[model samples]
Target chain A: EDQVTQSPEALRLQEGESSSLNCSYTVSGLRGLFWYRQDPGKGPEFLFTLYSAGEEKEKERLKATLTKKESFLHITAPKPEDSATYLCAVQAYGDVTSYDKVIFGPGTSLSVIP
Target chain B: DAMVIQNPRYQVTQFGKPVTLSCSQTLNHNVMYWYQQKSSQAPKLLFHYYDKDFNNEADTPDNFQSRRPNTSFCFLDIRSPGLGDAAMYLCATSRGRTSHNEQFFGPGTRLTVL
Candidate 1:
């Protein structure tokens, strides 16, 4: 079974504090790993997609890195506006003829106190 | 402007009553997805549409149904909604049928069951 797990269920950070969130997965064959930011009572916003190990992508103060079994989302100099639930989702190579399922982690709730 | 849109950002329903949530996307993506999310939990995929073809998840309840009459619109219908069915329903779209594609999400509809 393909599954995703994220670490540090909740984190409280001071403004400008830097931290990293971990996401680990178990899949038969990896297709892609995705990162998303979801504010309370809102939908998730797309962040980054990592397809292979050693792949890295960055946007503003956020950086995402992927490996064989895990992915990390690093936040640099966080701001209160950046506080939200970070979600990690993984896609596995299932039946090629049909659309595969994307497994999502429970997400890490981060609070940036300014 | 929101590329993906969900109507009735907040919905209220009585127990065992049927309700429909609407979603429309201007992106004209090839795939649309419906997900259910609860507080502090991951968004759970209920089903998705690849063009006009509907794919239902194995664990989805029979009380939940969906329809995609055209490429731009989709609807999620809950038949006999229960208290447990109260959740945030998210609508998303992707440019392709493959799971590797990044999905664009709309502000979700929060359902309240009485």
Candidate 2:
């Protein structure tokens, strides 16, 4: 069975703090790994997509790195605006029933206190 | 801008009442999906339409149903919403039902059961 898990279900960081969130997964065949940012009362916003081990992508203050069995989202100098739930999802080359199912992790809730 | 659009940013319904949530996309995508997200949890897949080919998840309840009238519009109907059904209903779209296609999401409809 394919599964995705994230560490530190909730994190409270002061403004400008730097930390990392972990996303570990077990899949039959990894096709893509995705990261999304979701705010309260809103749907998730697309962030980064990592396709292979050693692949990384970065935005303003966020960087995502992928590995064979896990992925990491590193936040650099995070601000209060960066406070949101971060979600990790994986799409694998599934069995005959479905090929495009995207499995999502429980997500990490981050609170950047000012 | 090409985007996924969901209506009724917030909805309040009585328990055991039927309600419908709607979504439309201008991205001209071939896939539309409905997800149920509770507080501090990952968005759970309810069902999806891959160009009119409806696919339901194995664990989805029978009270939930969906319809895709055209390439751009989709609807999710809950026959009898329970208090446990109060959640954020998210609508998402992808270019195609492929492993590499990333999903774009709408702001989501936050359902409140009374």
Identify the candidate with maximal lDDT.
1
Candidate 1 structure quality by residue, lDDT tens digits, A37-108: 999999999999999999999999999999999999999999999999999999887785655668999999
Question: What is the TM-score of each predicted model, taking all chains together?
Answer: 0.97, 0.97
Model 2 residue A91 CA deviation in Å = 0.7
**What lDDT score is found at residue A59 in candidate 2?**
98
Off by over 4 Å in 1: A96-98
Query: Lowest summed lDDT over 10 consecutive residues: which window, candidate 1 chain A?
Result: A92-101
RMSD of 1: 1.2
lDDT of 2 at A8: 88
Q: Give residue A9's error in model 2 in angstroms.
A: 0.6
TM-score of chain A of 1: 0.96
| CA lDDT of every candidate | 0.94, 0.93
- For candidate 2, the chain B TM-score comes to 0.97
DockQ values of all predictions = 0.88, 0.85
